[model samples]
Target chain A: MKLTKSFNRSLWVFHLNTGSCNGCEIEIVATICPRYDPERFGIKLVGSPKHADVLLVTGPVTKKMAAKVRRVYEQVPDPKLVMCIGTCGQSGGVFYDSYNLDGPIDQVLPVDVYVPGCPPRPEAIVYGVVKALEKLERLEAAQ
Target chain B: MLTDIILTLAGAFLVVIFSLIVAFFLLGVDRIVTARMQARIGPPLTQPFTDMRKLFTKENVVPANAIPWLFNLAPVVALASAITILLYIPIGGFPPVLSGGGDLILVMYLLTLPALALVAGGFSSGSPYATVGAQREMVTMIAYEFPLAVVIIAIAWKLAVSGVPLPFMLMSIQANPVWGLVGPLGIIGILILFFVLLIVTPAELSRIPFDTPEAETELAGGVLVEYSGKNLALFTLTQGVKTVVMASLMVALFIPYRLSALVPAPAILQPVLDLLFYLILVVLVAFVAVSLIRVSMARFRINQVVSVYWIYLSLIGIAGLLLVMADHFIGVV
Candidate 1:
């Protein structure tokens, strides 16, 4: 019980780069800066999806990546969170019209919170994350 | 008012410039860190800036079938939205230019507009790659959005219930103490919040783990497959600025300290020094959290990604909320 409590207290996040120009990837890294100290909030980034409670995904889904995206998403244990990070992830932004790209993330998955930004700031990401947690609790209570 | 505007603008300019520099530094740091973890030397810190400059001078190409206006507008809007977020945040104890009631919510919405603009821009291109990228982008957004929203509301609720007498604006939370991520439950809430942010951060910026959208190995640059020249450069700049903005927000909300916290310096000097301090701190955190994780971790499947967030993390969030509520009731009783 204590283990579950502590584990509940600290959620390990995993990041996945579907496909991006490395722009959003850098921003994602910025969120972990000491100034942000998400750890203070008991938030951490884990090395594997199996250990992760949330999956942070960026980039527009390409057909080739679809399987990989699905595969990784499946690897995460039950009751996980998925967050699409950039405009590219949300709607493929500048890549929307490309033949090689898939449409917005929703076609493949059900998103809980839409954190829109070509690349949202770390704080915005944090805010979206906090919001997602609240939503999760609400959903669970109802369930 | 004029003085405030001038100060705010100057501060914003500095913030934008600094954020870009920091972004470049992070890119280099990330590469070096990853390389070190993998037993190699990484690219130079200035590589991103150089790459952007080169892309700027490269040949500008427009798709023959694309809507020229939308394509052009996409990058501009993305950049603008990123800059706007910078202006609204508190850095080193300095409030943003547009700080007001529920501005945090506004910031939240504004952050996503750039992505929406990008999608529109891609759709305007009328290319298959761009279309596919847009679809994938949309899917990823759909997958993670709910959890993100829940996390935000939790923090806002905590602040609101704590009896801090300001609007639940992002700026107010920064300027006051009630919004601080302090308390054990708050810490737990923040931990879950952090994990959710960590996962989404890559997706928000389209990095590894959640980087399936533009898998060049698979999709040929995904959404940006057709973009080149200045348009690409614009996208590059926006990416850098967004990174800084994300980092800054974390500093404002989680850390919430400024140069002013160090000494009784003049207000102007304090904000500047605080901004610098915040940036340095961001650099340090990146070294551990992102750079380290990217090098060590691999990616996950899309459904697994969705289920974990919706089911698992949400359950954690529920527990946290219940604890908080219990704490609140116990305190009242």
Candidate 2:
């Protein structure tokens, strides 16, 4: 589905945690601080995936969580984006190639933007959101 | 007669549009005020409009197990009934389009229609989370209903006791301005009831300190867990419209005074002044009932919700009712 500027502006994101050690989760929380205030851009954290336009995935996918992540990705309505929020979701961070692992999140779901830090800072999360909007613009231009 | 009917239909259409504009503006103001209270820059005032556009264009998803017909109908019912409420209550200096002798009671009963639509929607969604939410919504409705009734009846009863014919008419209540009919003791009582109704406003809107049904952290959107796209957008609209309805009700009941009376406006300018003044009052009332308390409190447990309204607010409402009655029978009202 082609994206519109309205879709880009009012991005309702649902955060998914597969197997993060809580580092990225803390940064995600920090991104909502009065200092950061993502709401100024109309970025809201919605509880239901069905109401979301974007999914923020953090942490490497554990074997037990792989299916749940897939289920959640499908739960979001059409015209969606998946943003990988930490290095853990890209290369498993310190847990790379460990037993009981099933990820790097891209293996289980299509990731549109990756912010690669062991745990990215809140500033990085904000940049990741900007990059996501740029990607939307690219998609709109292509159409 | 046919032309008359067409004119009424056209007028009703215009009023519905006006109400929708006010409702959305109220929601945007709410977000901005809540953000400022938290020391954050909020979304633009046009954010709700942007959201509605995106939602209308997005894909509408129906849960496989859900009853499709009922699911689709719920949102339409919810929005329609909410807008229906705006038509019965007086706006600015104009009488209600459908004004009648006892339509205050009609407005009270109509207040429950949007809630009932929500309950129906939740029950039909076929999700365990929604089922729990529907139950909580039903419980919240039952808990808040008595005090709501008490508040309305107290004012009307005072009007009756004060010798106004057709005391149940909103026009009568508008003419009387319950605040003036009461002496000092009754003033205190009316103030108490005013406070109780302010507290009840959050519950009626399912806002925080009473928002267990949609507790996001726990139930993941609860009753709305399964709704998506257009359906969710309609429910969102219903929420904004309901806020306007509750705030308007409070305005009509307590502060229905017109600015034209004070300023002595010419005939051409009377409605313009009254309309501007009415909007200002609605904004203030919405700030108090919806935004202020929402920012100040946390969600209540379902059990606590029941006891708070049933035991605490009910007693307070009855006390106010008695005082209004007493102020009439005794001296200085």
Candidate 3:
């Protein structure tokens, strides 16, 4: 019970930088700070998607990162959430026309929330995380 | 009534703005927290603001097949619904700028509006990816709603038995945590709620492991395949505001201890200080949530999600409810 309680309270979020200028990546990092506090939502960023309840992917889906991104997505267990952290991840943003881009993060895995921005704001990321957590709980209930 | 509406409108607007401002700062905090978790230095506080400004000036586009009115309306509804939820929920002694007949149950449904709007927008886009996202969203909706509802219902039962008749709105719950969080059953309900709510947070916000609908790798932008410019910005803003809303909701339900100094102050200062205090608590909640994220892993399958919550959370919630009832009968309150 405690484990389940803690598991629910502490949702480990992972970040996958498929390919971007590092703009959204930095913002993603900003979300966990004391100021933005993703922890309030029971959200944290894990180094690996395997340990993440929510995999937060930033940047446009680049061809180079596609397979790796997919691999990471596969590693996350069931009831996991995927969040496309930026416009790039959503629709490729400015990178959409780039030959190296693979389109959006949703193309690779299911995304519960899409925080759209060339790089979205930290609060937006937090909001998106909360939404995903809500989705996670709802899914848990139905089962 | 007119005066009340005006006051409510004013309060709601302020809360909306406050939520937005808090969201940007929270974004900065999230970055810093995640960075430190990984042993790295994060960006400055103004980073999110700068990014938003940059996006505001970026090019806007509308897809040919998309319903322009609905597409434009989607993000607006999302933002509005989030802000509206915030308004209805009390943070500490603060009642939503507005309150009505229903309680937490109403807030729960109101919260789902943004997601519903997203699904609608996605389907309206007429793209395969968007449609797929909508479908995933629907499934996700089902996956999470039951457990959330169970938790809410349990809490409501507690409130009912206590004869407190909670506003069913989050604000009333927050204002009188003493009344809301009363009894051994209340505590158990809260504990069960802790798990249930924790699970609900990510899915509701559409964050990770469960983010299949908008999975960049599979559905591209998912529901947002064709959104751009202001429409996209609205969605982004909705996300930001919703983050604050979610955190605030948790704090409202769990931590209702208020700033002792605020009550003695002037009425105008009272609300401002109250708002600030609520934001601080939300920050704390976010910090705790982030710390938890550092160690946990995301669940992969949709089925697993359903099974875990339904089989586990439901039982837990039910147990808590029964325990509460027993405690009440035993005069253990």
Candidate 4:
């Protein structure tokens, strides 16, 4: 994937919930609030996968949601980054041994960054985004 | 004749560049001002430029279900039509490049072309969200057309009655400020018309309160749900240019006065002053019609959009038109 300096500055994110408890979703919303003001970094929450540069996935994928998650990941255009937020997406946090287990996200799609917490704080999500940008910068430099 | 053609071409190129720069600058300003209004620090003024660059570099995706040719053709058509409107409408102390070839009515028609292109793009995308958006866009277009026509026709009709030649010509309208042609009651009528036009400007540009077609929350970017990368960038540019076109039209029709005429400036400085004055007016109109209204109000439902334009705004527009007419007849008697 080709990348440029602009790719680092303006990152449009699309939030996806495979089957989270909604705690991570609320935290994601908090990250966008004026207190955090992600807009200052030119980060925007776009409505569609087509418009997104970053896929912000916030859940442990269930059997029913794994296919849908992959489809959405495909829907995002090339040169995209995926960040799995919350502990559920990292190790299925609370539902680690559930029968319908299909994901810790990376099983379903390649994730570039991971934010581990029961429900990661807004600061951690922001830090994860910073790390994602660092990865993008490294890729840009390698190119 | 060859030199004339080359000069005209060069001038057209310059206008395109100038309009693009100004439009992007205005967009950035709108973002900053909106953020301030919301009590938060906004992105830098150059954010739109960076965003555009990123969009241009991203992968262009063509949905499997989409008609590639028509889907791609729409953004090009939209941008072209938007720039074409600028060729006819006077900009910043300069007469339109194609002023002699077209007039107000032609401009009115040209205004619809960009929106039509958008609708075409939406329908061709083969996405249910986009299809619904196109239908809503068509409905919004139909709703706004009447009040828009009323405002334009009222001014031209007033000019025609006053024995102005080529009443529908934008040059003629610019030469004769609509404000100077009316009595006290007619002035009130013109003010009312101006207010109606201010309300129309946002709807014309598909901003908030009239952006039901692109309701990001409900429709997931709606008409633009399927577009990506380069095509999306072109649509964004088209939007910025369309804002310039609409604001410039408002400036030409209602506030065509030049600073050069009012103050004694050196001949060299006159155009500069007038251009600055014109820019100020355009920005003011944009701030009021777009930013202020957008900040203060919520998006109207598509049905509510139709009623607001067709019922409330149209009634206000006609009342203003009658006032202008009554003022004219009252003066004659």
> Residue A51's C-alpha lDDT in candidate 1?
41
**DockQ per candidate, 2 decimals:** 0.02, 0.85, 0.03, 0.84
Give one digit per residue, the lDDT tens place, for model 2 in B1-333. Answer: 898678767767977898889988999999999999999989999999899989987999999989999999999999998888887888999887666433788888888898888999998999999989989999999999999999989988888878888888888889989988888889988988888888899988888989999889888898899999999999999999999889889999989899999998789999999999999999999999999999998889999999999999999999998887787767842
A best-first ranking of the candidates according to their lDDT comes to 4, 2, 3, 1
Error of 4 at B61 (Å): 0.3
Q: Which stretches of candidate 1 lie over 4 Å from their true place?
A: A1-143, B1-11, B178-183, B262-269
lDDT at B118 for candidate 2?
Answer: 91
Candidate 1 lDDT over B131-217, as tens digits, reads 877777777776666666766676677777777655457765666643343456556656666566555566666666666666655
Model 3: C-alpha RMSD to truth?
14.6
Error of 1 at B109 (Å): 0.4
**TM-score for each predicted model, relative to the true structure:** 0.65, 0.98, 0.66, 0.99
For candidate 2 chain A, which ten residues in a row score worst on lDDT? Answer: A1-10
Compare candidates 2 and 3 on TM-score and give the better one. Answer: 2
The candidate with the higher lDDT, 2 or 4, is 4
Top lDDT model: 4
Query: Which parts of model 3 have CA positions greater than 4 angstroms off?
Result: A1-143, B100-102, B166-172, B178-186, B261-273
lDDT of 4 by residue, B46-80 (tens): 99899999999999999999999999999999999
B-chain TM-scores per prediction:
0.88, 0.97, 0.87, 0.99
Pairs that collide, model 2: none
Candidate 1: docking tier: incorrect
lDDT of 3 at B159: 62
Q: List, residue by residue over B1-333, the lDDT tens digit for candidate 3.
A: 899888877887778777788878876677666667655555456555554553343345555677888877888888888888877777655656766654677788898899999998888877777888888887887778887787667666666666665536565565556334466655765776766777677667666656667676566557866664456667767877777877877787667667755367866677677767877888877665543453355534667667766787677767766766676677743
Which runs in model 2 stand beyond 4 Å of their true positions? none
